[model samples]
Target: MENLPKKVRSKKLSTRVDLTAMVSVSFLLIIFFMVTIELAKPKAIDFNLPDNEWTYRGTHISCGPDVTRIVTILLDDNNKIITYSGLLFTPIVDPKVLNYGKNGIRQELFDRRKNITEYSTAIGKPKNGPIVIIKPSKKSNFKNLVDILDEMAIANIDTYAIVSDFTPEESKLLALK
Candidate 1:
């Protein structure tokens, strides 16, 4: 008998998948989400405390400028704002009694800011504008203080200070209304 040649069959293999592209896309998506979300900024009220050492060159300590363009605001217990401008020694103009609203303190602040800017420019001292001194009386609540601060910011005031002292005259004014 003659030897017959047997046919050999080739074994089939499964398709191999390349996961490199999918992994790169997934990593890119994660990075994109991380960059898009914004973080919240902390809000705070700015306050300055007096230094413990109160002597300047063997004399009483004094701070800030002694100028005419100063606005003093006294916040009273009844949610009333009593405001006066110029030096304390200078004769006080009638204290303006204002409420907290768009047409109240905000309007007054805007008008005062405008007048101060104009006055400074006319006198050739453009940098010498108004400075607001906020004195919140013990009678006043926390909300009142916050409102005045918000008004200052809305009116675009650049210079302001929170002082705790209240002159006797200011105390009397608060007593009026």
Candidate 2:
């Protein structure tokens, strides 16, 4: 090859890379993480099923975190307690409300406690502890509802829930909380 003389001649040049594919991949990874992380996380209260001889029946009511006793209460159309599953039981009894203030509700609560004990004994898991689920009808009066709640509290129930169907109009009723 022959060498040529250069008279201080030079040129400036640059190159650019297309990062569209990399950005697309990064977006896909972000979406995957968001979708999975949102579902995998546990919420304020994780519900767990307790070992109970339950029959397939009316609506189920669950409360509190997983791995604990959760009482399930079933109410009849007449706004009376038909059956309640917990520490106390009245054995397929039609629980009537006297609404005679403290003494009346207390007596009913005592009967509930006795039933629970008897059933627990029959099932060979005798524990005199109190865990009740009060299933009152939507038409039940506030006084009756409060009375049941008070009785449950008096029975030493720290955790329970008032089960009811959610309606659009009733959604605003959340203010009662």
Candidate 3:
């Protein structure tokens, strides 16, 4: 019997994977996210806060601008906004309930601002915009405050204040309305 040469068996090779590419890609992804986060920082609303005196005085006292230039806005519950010119005690423009939107508080603000500006110019007073006082009642929500703030910005009002405290008389007036 002829002995056949033993067939040579091929050596089994273990699969080897290079992790350098994966590690580099992961590092690139992390760096990309970090750069994006650094570039896209959260935006904040710019506020011009009053001094301690005004804070202590609250909305009851007339400390800010003159009565002629002042416009008070009260934010109540149920998306109701009450606006009037000057102090609540002696209002230049009678208090009227207003809603939110272009036609509601926004229109009133625009008209008031324009009228105030014209009046100031006619009276030879310095051409200054109306001073808006935003008073959010206890029943009011945050959205009301934000909407009023947006109105203030849209109206291009320079002088404005957000007073948390409401006078007793003001509260009564709100209840009546």
Q: Going through the candidates in order, what is the number of backbone clashes in each?
A: 0, 3, 0
Q: Which of candidates 1 and 2 reaches a greater TM-score?
A: 1
lDDT per residue (tens digit) for residues 91-132 in model 1: 334468999989988888887788877866775667655678
lDDT of 2 by residue, 1-177 (tens): 357776786675656778999999999999999999999998775422344443223333354321123344543333344333322222244323344345555566666567655755765667533355565656566766776776776765545567776434223322221
Can you give the lDDT of residue 156 in candidate 1? 85
**How would you order the candidates by lDDT, starting with the best?**
3, 1, 2
**How many pairs in model 3 have backbone atoms within 3 A of each other, for residues 3 or more apart or on separate chains, i.e. clashes?**
0
Off by over 4 Å in 2: 1-49, 54-91, 128-131, 138-144, 165-177
Please identify model 1 stretches exceeding 4 Å from their true place.
Answer: 1-66, 89-92
Give each model a TM-score. 0.62, 0.39, 0.64
Question: lDDT of each structure?
Answer: 0.76, 0.51, 0.82
* Best model per lDDT: 3
Judge candidate 1 against the unseen true structure and give its global Cα lDDT, from 0 to 1.
0.76
Q: List the residue pairs that clash in candidate 1.
A: none
